[model samples]
Structures are given as C-alpha cells and as structure tokens.
Target: MTAVQPKPTPVGETFDSLNPATDEVVGTYAVHTADEVRAAVERARGAALWWEGLGYAGRAERLQRWKGVLTRRLPQLCQAVRDETGKPLRDAQLESVLAIEHISWAAKHARKVLGRQRRSTGLLMANQAATVEYRPLGVVGVIGPWNYPVYTPLGSITYALAAGNAVVFKPSEYTPGVGKWLVDAFAEIVPEQPVLQLITGFGETGGALVGAGVDKIAFTGSTATGKKIMAAAANTLTPVVIEAGGKDPLLVDVDADLDAAADATVWGAFSNSGQTCIGVERAYVHERVYDDFVAKVVEKTKDVRAGSDAAAQYGPVTMPSQLGVIRRHIADAVERGGKALVGGVDSVDDRYAQPTVLVDVPEDAEAVREETFGPTVTIAKVRDMDEAIEKANATKYGLGSTVFSKTRGVELASRLRAGMTSINAPLSFAGIASLPFGGVGESGFGRIHGPEGLREFSRPKAVARQRFTAPITLTSFHRRASADPMVARLVTFLHGKR
Candidate 1:
C-alpha cells in the first residue's frame, strides 16, 4: 500500500506536480521549510496590520481589482486547475466562476457583515451605549485541498482578505501550480504588501504553517489530518476552522420526483470523481419506489464516465494513491453481499475510476462506514423516512445532504443532521453565496461563505461607552443607606414575579 504520510523533505528541496492523466510534470515548486513558512507568516503578520488599516472600503477596492484580474485571466486559471487536477475544462471553469462569485460576494458583503453597529443597551444598563463589530485577526493561514484547488481555498482566502486579514496559503502539494497561479494573479493587482502569500510543499510544510504563529488557520482536508492540524495549532493556541470529510447522504421519498432524484443522485455522487467533501456517498430510497429509483439511477450512471478524453463527463483521479481505497471499498461491498448495479471492483484503473453503484451494502461495511473518496455510491431501501434518517445519521460525518420530496422537502431536510442540505436538488448549496458552508461531528466545525465566513477569520470587538452618569450610582463607591433598598426594590419591580 502507498504510504499516507507526508512526502520526505530535505532542506531547500523542490518537487514536481504531475498531471494525473498523463503523469507529465506540470509544474515544479520548492518544498518550503518550516523557517520559510514562519517567514511567510511573519510577513503576513505585518501585512495584516496594513491591510486592516485600509479599512473595508480600501480593501474592497483592492479585492475587486484582484477579482477583475482573475476574471480576465480566467482561461489560464482554469487551465492550471485542469493541469493540476485531472478535472474537465468545463468543471474547472465552473469552479472558477464560483470562486469569482465568492470573491465578489465577500468583497461586497464584508463591510456590511463586519462593520460596527449600535447595539441596544437594555434597561439594566440604560446609561451605557454599546456597539459591536468584527475585527481582523491578523494573519490567517489556509491549507487547501486538491480536489477543488480553486473554489475551496478561495472560500477562505477571499473572505479572510475581505475581512482585513492578510493570508498565508499552502495549497495541496498536488496542485501547487494552481496555487502559484492564484498568488501570482493577486500579486499583479495588490503588489504593495505580501497580503497573500503562497507556500508549496507536502504535509510537513502544512504542519509548519499551523504553528507559524498565524492568528488563525482555515483548513480543508480529511478528518485525520484535521485532527493533526488542530493538535499543531494548539501548540500556539492558534484558532482553526476545519472543513473536513463528509459521507453525506441523499434521501429519496416515495412522493419525490424519480427522474429528478436519479439525475441529482448520479451527479452529486460522481461529480469531481467523488472527490467532494459534500458529495453524496449514500442514497436512501423509500421502499414504495425503491426498484424504480434503483433502475433509474443505474441507467443514468451508465451514461456518466470517467476518463482522460474530452468526451468524458469527469476525468481521472487526481491522487493516484486513492485508486487503492476505491478498489478496496468496492471489493469489500461486493464481498459483503452487495450488488454492483454499475461498474464493479475492476472498474478502478491506475488513474481513473469509472462510476460504481452498489446496492444492499451492509451499513457497517467500509464503503458505507468510511469515506470512499471515489466515484462510487451505495443505495439502500428504507421502510420509511424514519429508517432513512436513522441510517443516514449512523455515520460519523454530517457535512452536506440532499432530499427529494414533493411534500416533505422542508420537513426531511430539517431533520437531516448536516451542515447544508439541498431540497429537490444536489450540491446546489455550494453555489449560493448567502449560505454558510461547513459541517459538524467528524465532518468538522466552523463555517465559510456568507456572514459566518466573514466572521470566521475575525474576532468580535464590543465597545461600551458611558453616555452619562447614572442617578442610581450602581457602580459608585459612595452610596447612601437607602440606595441598597432602592436598588433591591428596582430589581424586584423589574424582575420579581408578580
């Protein structure tokens, strides 16, 4: 088995990022050392002060300029993403558009979401005036994933920049080219400060970033790695927002749209070659229409393919080591008496994995219990929605889920134990800028996107001012004898039971 540990590093060493489809070296980057990471963070720490000094309007102007640069060079960015990750050009472009949208949203909404506002000083503190706002937390370090080399990291980087924090980003070693491209693009627009810096390397470099004294770290990766990040960040007491793993589910109700459910399930399960943290890994269909749903899903999945060719719906698996995990999951499911309605164990090749759909997989099997992280999904029949919800909630992860119900969409979606759930659709929540995205439990905590995202890289600063002296003199040392009884009477008058 391929080792899951970080690639070995020597001082001042460099590595090559290869294209998964052809094993061709796409880009070469230095494997930055701990000292280099620390230097980057220190630079960002200084830049953070300057960035925050610009206030919201100035930063928004710069961010808009950066966004414009990214928009104009969209083709190059998309091509870089395609080279690093073996996703289709269209998929890269789609994520590019979404990343740009987030950049625009964060730039436009940061001032409104984090700006100071007058807060009511309740009757108890009538003489005091209160105001609250979010302030930047200095440098923010982001460790991004390779699957979404653009959108996922931008979700954190853009929001952090808009919130007035300078960022130090360490993109996945597998996608360093895309990372370099992003940093280079930002440089052309905001060349004044190292407000956004890039460090390229494997896991050791990422661990260094965690303890580089950055105020906060936004990490998107696996749960096991998230735990390690939390541990490293704990050394400096650096806060973290971890966007980790997800074995999200999709529920198909008896009254739902079968064709729509089939289409959504297929797309959500296999898109990005199932490299999405919020991708649907499990499907629970109501017993009333189980057979029909399975047939439709199998039919739809047959048309979806994974290859390096232009005609394929998806491309090769970016991480070659993941092929073993996909194979194991498929083998385990079939051995456990599960039926493969589509591709089977042998479908996983050296680089690409064709879509695989398994039915009647045991709940405790690895395919259902662990994160497959491949173009594979499991479908099961549930006697009722209650059974479906119970089975869905059985996993340790709760990231993103989907529900298709003609009448109970809201009801079923509300009951799902996930961070974001789409009703009658799949993965639609990721496109809506106003929605907060993240997860609970093994999927991880904290949020990115919308107002919550802006606040994620910030610390709330609350201010209270004395409008005038109070007659009651509750805070004064010089109090008359009757003052105690007067205060007691006031408290009784306001809070005591009638």
Candidate 2:
C-alpha cells in the first residue's frame, strides 16, 4: 500500500463536503492553499525516490496488499462514493470493485510492461547492446472529477503508483471525502513514506498543484478547463494527461439486439445522472429497427427514476450549476423541433433530474454538439452503418463509443475515432484492464489503464552498452571512409531485397 502524506499544515476556514442528494453536510475538510500544495509536492518528491527504489516486484507486492485493503473495505468506499456523487449503491459498488481489478492488474503487469528490457539494435548499430526502461517521473499530480470519483482518478493513481511515482491527488471539491478516505486507508500499510497525498480545495487549488513542479499532471474534467490546465502546466513545462468531457455516441445496426441496445442506452445515459465521461449521450439507430429501438428505450427509461431514495437508479446532479446546463439542453432541444418521448425541460428539479429522452433533435443543437452531462439522450435514425459512423464521429470529442450489431459490431467500432469502442457493451473498454482508456481532439490526450496507463506516468530511458567495437569506427576524427561503405552495405542487406 502507498503511504499517505499527512495533511498539509492547516489553511483557511475549512469547508464541508455536501451530499448532492439533499445538500446535507457529509464531512468537513481543509481548503488547501497554494503553500500546502507546494509542501505536499515536496513531500511526494521524497516518497517517490523511496518508491522508485523498491523496484517492480516490491511495488507490486505493496499494490496487491492495497488491493486487498480496498476489497475488504469495498462497502465503506462505495458508500462514500454514493454519498458524494448521488449515484446508486449498486453502481458505486461496481465502480469500486472495478477499481480493485485495475489495481490488481496494474501491479501484476507493471513489471513486464515498464521494467528494464533488452532491445535489438538496428543493423547499423548491431555491435552495441541496447535496452529500454521506463523510469518514474517523480511526483504526479492528479486532478480528479466528481463523477465516478473512485474509479476515474484511481485509473490514473493506481497506474502511477505501480510505476513507482508518488502522487498528490486533488479530487473534485464535491467528492473530497472519498479522496480522504482512500488516502487514510493506504496510510495504514505504508507508515514510513508519504507516497499518496491529498490536497483538497476548489479550482485554484487544482491550478496550484498543476504548476507546482510536479513531473506530470493527470486531470479529468471539462475540455474548457482542460485547455486552462494545459496552459497552466505549460508555464513549468510539466507534462499532463487530460481526460476531458465527451459526447459519446452509441450506434445500433439493423441486426442489433434491440432489447440489449435499449437496455444499455437507458443505463448508460442515465447512470450517475449521466455525468460519466464515457456515457452514451447520443444514439444513432439504423432505420430498419429505429422504431423498435426507440420504443424499448422509452420503456426502460420510464422504469428508472432519479431521486434521493435508495430505490432510485439515478441521482441528483453533484454540482448545482450542472442542473442549469441540463435544463438548457432539454429546453433547446425542445425549442428546435425535438420531441420529448418521455421527459422534457421541466424535468430538472432542485436536486434530481428525471430521465429525459429527446427525439427529433436537430443535429446542430447544443444537446448534440455540446456535452449534455445529464440523464438525457437524443435518438436519431440513420440510413446505414456508414451514416451511423459519420454521425458518431461528427463530434469534436472522441473519448468512447458503443456499437451494437451482430455482424458488424467489430467492423463499425474500428471506424470510430474514439480512444475506446465497446462492441455490444456500454463502457466495456474501461472494464477490460488491458485496453487503453482516453480520447483525442477536444476529449483530450494521454491514456490511463492498461500498459498505456503505466507508461503515462513514466519516462522512457534508453541505455546502450558496447559489446564489441565495430571493425570500421566512425565517431572520432579517425578514418571513417570504410565505415560509411560498411553502414551502406548493412542497410542494403536488411532492406534492399525486402
């Protein structure tokens, strides 16, 4: 288990984490100031050296033990996740367990993927032995989101830890308790080091950490904020990984299982109040089965309710301002010739947003172009898979997409430009511990989870050792006329006949 750096010396008036469901105060935490951010980074710098010295096997053992701790305390973590984000207990549990899987996988696989390994030198340099290894990049600063707080940040944090880097995580203000809980648990196993640290506050605190000379920053937030983060990190030339918002699309083909597609759409769009980065915001169905698919989706959407009660499948918006965005998206869609098959603009309540499914929305409306980050999905009919692909790739964000087609699921999924595409499954790419998770364009760059996740937190270091001197030397002011011909001969021997 990674060490938890003790909370930085206290700062301004502390803030209370509010339960999004009812606005009740759940826990009180310090509003970490800029000075605290720098202090934490300094502590992490020390811890990282120790962690890196542990090497691959030592870190892997500690990580597996940490996974054991998480598995044993799964319920406690899930409750914290639910209280902070207003997502259902089942969904929270699922995310917590999935995070455990990633922790286990990253620890078990990091040595193979990131440890020093020999590489063959090209023909020109065959006399030298070459090797490549990934080295920890000191302290890593992770700015996590309120939505899927446990799973999303852990995706970056676990990988970073497995790669032997100490972490300073600044979870979204809305879900700080969950962050504190995780840090505290890890502290039990690693008391000697400050390997995993938490600094709680709002946007300014996050910005402070980004510029605090950390080797890298892993941020999951809005694209607008991502741009701001990029600009901030640029000041110090700090590398960053941004998992920005997405308007992911779910495509259904003529031969798709309408029942399954409908079920996935309802859950994917409405889960976590549709606050997920990889959630299905748009559904493009082939014309052959459009009516059936829409009907099934409406039926499923009716059964899911958003509320503060235990029975509710969906929950309130974690951030209050997000309610206004949800309301506007529904209103704009309705105003622009879109028909509400179930919910409408008035569905946005003070706390909970009723499931809203808008059909016939214009392609250019905010609901389609911008991220609706709520439990609302727009359904459209396309002539064929080609048209579906076109509409799916139309958005600027390419984070994740879903395809449901018996014969063409794999083929069509390959065409989408997103980082991950799930065939017949919603967000399945995130669950597969080996696949990379992230996106391109406005959805942001850098990957988390899988081999890519471990590599993201590290810098490649290449080492070349001379085994035997070449017959024709060429480095010094010595004779190299013969060496040039020898190099040409090697290149021709390797590639001329190919």
Candidate 3:
C-alpha cells in the first residue's frame, strides 16, 4: 500500500483532504475564521425565521423534497464520500441511504413530536385552560464527525430542521466535500432561504461555531473535545447536544448461538475499519464457551480484508494519525500478556490496518481501556454472565453494547450501562428511527433521533386561559383575608391525610 501523504496548503488559507487509501488530494476547502462562522450564524438566524414561518406542514414538504434530491443524487454523494474517507463505495452509499431514511422519518413525524398540544389542568386550576407547544430554537450550530459523516450529522441536522430551526453545519476537515454537497442540494430544494449552510475547517472552526450566537450546538467527536465545546458554549449559555466517542463492548453468554455471536462480533468490531463510535471495541465471552467462541471469531475474521477494492469488506483508517494509535494498542496488549489470535501489530500498514483481535488482555491495558478507533478488538474471558456484565460496564465510556443470549437478552441489556444496546445483533438501534441514539458518561449527552431529538432543538411554550371566574381569587392583590383561610382549609382537606 502507498503511504497516505497529505499535501500542504498553498499561499491561500485552504486545506487539502487526502484520500487515506491512495495519498491523493481529494478536495480543497477554506479554513473559515471565527468571524466568518459568526456571520454564517447570523445568516442562519435570519433564515430560521423564514423557515419557522413555514410551519410544520410547509417545512415537512420542503424536507421531503430535500430527501428526494438526496435519493436522486445519491451516487454523486457516495462517490464524494468514498473519495474523501477512503471507505468502500458501498459503505458510503449505505450511510447515505440510512441518512435519507432518518430525514424522511423526521419530516413525517415532526408534527406529532414537536407540534402544539393540549396539556392537563388539574382541579386547583380548573377555571383555567392550559396548553403546551414546542417552539423552534432559532439557529443551531452543528460540529460533525468524519466517520459516518452523512448519517451522524444528519441525525442532528434533520431533526433540528424538522423542529423548525435553521442550521449552520461544520463538517470534519476530512469530509468537507460531502458537507458541501448536502448544502448545495438542500439549497435546490429550498431556494429562497439559506436554511442549511456549510462551514469547512478543523477544530478551530468548530470552536468558533460553538461560540457563535446559535440557539443550540450539536457536536460529535472525542469526549475531551466535548468538554471544550460545553465550556466554550458556557460563555453564551448556549445549549448543546454532545455525541462523543465510545469504547463500546459486546458480551457473549454461555447460552448464545456461538456462530451468530461470533459473526456479530466480527462485523461490529471491524466495520468502517472500526472507526464507529458505537462499534464493538471490546468483548467479554462466557468462559464455558470461550474457546469455541474465539475459534468462530477467528474463522469469521479470516476472510475479511481492508483495501480500496470492491471485494474488500472495509477500507483504510480514515484518519492517518489513527494508524499509530492502532499499532500502539496492539503492542501494549501484547506487552501486558495478551495474545493476538489474529493479525498482530504488523497487520497495520501506512494506510490500512488489517483486522486484529487480542485475547486475555488485562483490563487496564490501553487496548481495553481507551478508544482505539481502529479495526481491532480485545476479547476477555468471564466466569459467567454476571462477570461479563461487570466487565462490559467497566469502561468510562457508555455508548453502546450488544448482548447475545436468547433467554436473558433483555434482562442483560437492561443491566448494561450504555445509551443503547442490541439484544441479539449489533448496532440495530442506529437503524431504527424511533429509537433515540446518544450516550451517557464520557460518551456525551442529549439524543439525536426519535421524539427526544425533536424536542432537543425546540423550546416548550405554555399558555393558560381563564375559562371562568374562580370562587377563590388568591392571585389578586385585592383578595379578601377570609379567602386565605379558606384556601388553607381546602389544601388541608385534600392532602392532610396523605
């Protein structure tokens, strides 16, 4: 494989995105400054007013048109993703397809999820009619990640738009072209307003977007960076939805179908070259079936390879710097008495890192403890399901997990400490539009799908109307002294016994 080299920018303030597979420049994008980002936010705020004025019916119509554009020009977007990220064309297409579904679901359900609805009025306020409704939060700033760039960022952008907010999105420097494509397509669907705008650059650009006077900021990246975003947004008290990294784990039970469990583990751990935030980074197997399960994993992983070819199941690590991290993780696991059952440190090359699996890695080893963000997994043995659950939940990151047991799947899934867990498969929650996807702990907070996602970008507005005259008018300053005693007596009669 050729070394993945990036060419430096010329005199202008621009950066080149290199295809990790071939070390070739894919595209050039401007390194937007903070002021430029704020300008974009200001523009977005104006666009949001026009967008919000459309109401749910009008907005949904436009969003559906946007989805049609995406579906129609999917091939162009897929090739763009492939050129930038070096993933297989099929993977790129799959991500884009999933993103399309999410947008469609969000558009269809926005009315029910975020529209005005009547709220309850209790006996004490019987004379008043109360109603609660969701109002758009104006402009939202989104900082997206490179891996699953299309699908992940849309999880926020689509829902935000569905909830009646304009968005200024900053894609990862590695995948700016994809972001540009999306913005241009949306413009075709809604030509009158800049409802969706694109900003291209690196972390500094993202930091600027966080500080921009956008109503909300949705970020997806490392936990440490999530903290920085939260702190920076604090300057303006801007709300944010943080979807950070994760060291997701998969637990195999003694009663699990060994063949199925092994297949799920291999696919979950190595898909997208293991750059997934919710991918299986670690595994815990019941000791009763440890040897068999490991054998199956080895067999299933043997035929898999990473390359920029159609036959390959995956491609190179999108971020070149991650190659070193994958190497160090394998070396550390070996130094700490772990055994490499598959490709070892040598599996990692300048571009692609072959599938590597480690066994018996110490719990404290960097391979098991940290997010490797590569196509490697550390499998450990547990005496029983209880031990498996304990080991699985040990990580500081609680993003996603998988449980492979027929009888105890739900029970075990409930016990796992994660934002979402698959009962019999892997990463299923991500495909289900109704399921809100996000993480807890170091993985970050706030959801980006389903009803929760709709509300995230909306503010609840409540209204109350006086239906008739009340016998007790305690709210009025001119209320008689006798009314206070009567109210006290009524309150005592209602709640004194309980």
Question: By TM-score, who's the top model here?
Answer: 3
Query: Which is better, 1 or 2, measured by lDDT?
Result: 1
Q: Estimate each model's TM-score.
A: 0.97, 0.96, 0.98
lDDT by residue (tens digit), candidate 2, 214-292:
9999999999999999999998899999999899999999999999999999989999899988999999999999999
Instruction: Single out the weakest 10-residue window by summed lDDT for candidate 3.
Output: 3-12
Over 4 Å off, model 2: 1-12, 489-498
Tell me how far the alpha carbon of residue 379 in candidate 1 is from the true structure, in angstroms, after superposition: 0.6
Off by over 4 Å in 1: 1-12
Q: Candidate 2 vs candidate 3: which has greater lDDT?
A: 3
TM-score of 3: 0.98
Rank the candidate models, highest lDDT first: 1, 3, 2
Clashing pairs in 1: none
- What is the C-alpha RMSD, rounded to one decimal, of candidate 1? 2.2
Question: Which lDDT tens digits does candidate 3 get at residues 1-498?
Answer: 576555334336798887877878888889999999999999988899999999999999999999999999988999999988888889999889989999999999999988778888877888999988899999999999899879999999999999999999999888898999999999999999899999988788899988888899999998999999999999999998999989998989889999999999899989899999999999899899999999999999998999888999999888878899999999999998999999999999888999999998999999999999999988899999999889888889999999999899999999999999998888999999989999999999999999999999999999999999999887989999899898888888888885
Off by over 4 Å in 3: 7-11
